[model samples]
Target: MGNCCRSPAAVAREDVKSSFSGHDNGKRDSSVAAKKAPVTVLAGVPKENIEEKYLLDRELGRGEFGVTYLCIDRGSKELLACKSISKRKLRSAIDVEDVRREVAIMRHLPMNNSIVSLREACEDDNAVHLVMELCEGGELFDRIVARGHYTERAAAAVTRTIVEVVQLCHKHGVIHRDLKPENFLFANKKENSSLKAIDFGLSIFFKPVQMRSNVVVLWPDVAAPL
Candidate 1:
């Protein structure tokens, strides 16, 4: 994931190649066109333009299949983040299923101060947009690098917060496969701002009877205190 705390002065755009192709004899193939149609990543979402509700501003970050932008609600003028995933990038059935599962898992989790909240989810003809609360304080990895070393109390507090987040996910039958300093962000730039887990792209719902080999782990190397 790209850093979301970068300056949003410049806007960025990504161009994707169209999957459809013209016939050899200058005629279009209707059947092939239908086969290459854009996949609907999210179900039950009305095909409404995302720009109608939120004004997408400068780009904040870019991932493999989507871009995160600084957005504002047109009605309330509240600042938020919009993560738009392009349907063209979801080439395979597994890729499409992963995107759908990500949205479902985020919505399935209960409200918590330690987890970033999803405001709304909208889908259009081209992409699926996820509107969420914006965290501007930057990633935990950067914070630790700047501070050089952490005090005993500060380290303990950080450890306790991370454990609580994991416990909460387990309670909800959701396992966050990716947990690291880069995945955690402070709510604001304040000294005592709450740290929140921001990404769930790799999370999945698990049952107690499931085999241990089904779990995926991406643990961080925490040789010393953060």
Candidate 2:
């Protein structure tokens, strides 16, 4: 792919993509769209600016939709990862609506220890807030870079954990379009810590059977197109 300016007619569609995006009109899934409410959105990144319920700290990282900040809840002093997504960053009305669907998915995703938990959502005119559990162990690639290499058993363990996560997401009708070492993080700094999948900004929800076509898997001895 070559870098080029997007014409007015060819606005980027990746922002609106899903596994079943064969004929997307930039609308939310019908099931979700039906329940979407019409409401004004507010904006702000920090806790004070958006709300005083939490105290926002320095940036942890940035994603497709916004920056992630470390926050401490006032009442419980619970550490959290808040994704601050600016309304201006949303490319179109559809992008704005998708934000709602995204938040809903995060909040209601089946309880899983390997997935980051979304605690709450706070919104203002400036941005939409996605408050999530704080995972401080950092990205998987960082761990690998620090350790240099791993034993075969350890590698197999990590691979198995990752495969299970992918299976879980697919079972929920979500396709995490962007899955890389940079997106998976450990729960803590332990020799055998488990991993958690984060950053659902590019994930899309589809119907149950929509993902059955076009798929493949690779094993040590053979590459199979499923």
Candidate 3:
């Protein structure tokens, strides 16, 4: 899948900050100083800059609603990956509300070894940018294919992690009905083989009892008649 890059419209959604620290002959021109450098700032890029924020160089991944990127927060100089969800794909008005609710879910989620938790959110009229922990290890799908199918023990271990995530979601009254291999990712294999679940495209926060459609999609294993 192709990574989502910032489009002209998306870029226009933030207030980006620019700097001009370099100068020729070690001299600061008075005229230039008075001009304030006419900062080429984007309205949404600067999305509530809290300090030490990082700019994204390239996109890391893509999802149903948006794209993910490896970014650097300039304040602490820490690396983070940002998942930006476009307003368009969040079709239903109710689905938009669910995205906000999911953010709350991320905050309440425990800092465990099983899944990824959101760090912060950047908002604008066009999209919702989620800052999350950056995983250097990459996705589990790539790893599995490279090493062939996992051994019984490895599979069992991963399955346990999956269960933990599902249990957490259940506790929060949310159901990630779409559980698949591609959604699982590894943060660092050499340091620690911890899995971080990504993608909340089909996640629902309300109970199945509240929505009849939820009951139908609960069983994803069986193919539905075309």
Candidate 4:
């Protein structure tokens, strides 16, 4: 129970001892400690100041580990959504790996109208930022609830879009583990705005054979696994 049950003050002292252990003179190497302290969530992403490139506006949404902000590009003045995931909230190695996999999957997928495009991913000491296309319409679930129901044609259209997205993911050897209306968002507030699949936090890369075991049927009675 050395570190596991150590008090905050004891932990701080232990950290101080470890930091100066490398030096015979007992002086800590600030640069060495700084370089080794921060965790790297995304591989190959150079550390950059996110604020210099984008202005993080009002928060659009919040989840357990991160916040989605309305980000504006400083150079082109383009509107984008920035999902900033706090490093502090990444409580374990698995949490950090999940973020890395999500970013990798998004970058691996080909550009498609049915999927939200990730513009860029950057990180600093505090957080990992994912800049993606802004979908202002709203969640698909909310729209369905507000309208009470969808017309036969509208329902069919939505179904087709969702199927297409799933197909695209399977074609590229990726499986979106989480699929639901809440994860889909409309690109705009128009009546006929295109729906895009947004969240890939739970997605994973798989082999073609793995697809058979992972059955995803949008309509249980009528739909077959693709």
Give the alpha-carbon lDDT of every model: 0.80, 0.71, 0.67, 0.83
Ranking by TM-score: 1, 4, 2, 3
Tens digits of per-residue lDDT, candidate 3, 1-226, equal: 2453554135534322122334454454576565322221123344454222557657888766667877777677688888876665566767677677567667666776677767887665556778888888877778877888888998898888889889887776777776777778888866257887876656767675764562655335434554
State TM-scores per candidate.
Answer: 0.82, 0.71, 0.69, 0.79
lDDT of 4 by residue, 137-211 (tens): 999999999999999999999999999999999999998877888889999999999999988988889997665
Where does model 2 exceed 4 Å of error?
1-49, 212-226
lDDT of 2 by residue, 106-195 (tens): 765787988888887877545677888999888998998898998899889888888988899888878766677888899888877878
Clashing pairs in 1: none
- Top candidate (lDDT): 4
Off by over 4 Å in 1: 1-35, 219-226
Off by over 4 Å in 3: 1-52, 206-214, 218-226
Q: Which window of ten consecutive residues has the lowest lDDT sum in model 3?
A: 35-44
Tally clashing residue pairs in candidate 2.
9
Q: What TM-score, to 2 decimals, does candidate 4 have?
A: 0.79
Task: Please state the error at residue 10 of candidate 3 in Å.
Answer: 4.6
User: Which regions in candidate 4 have their CA more than 4 angstroms from the true location?
Assistant: 1-36, 212-226
Q: What is the lDDT for 135 in model 1?
A: 95
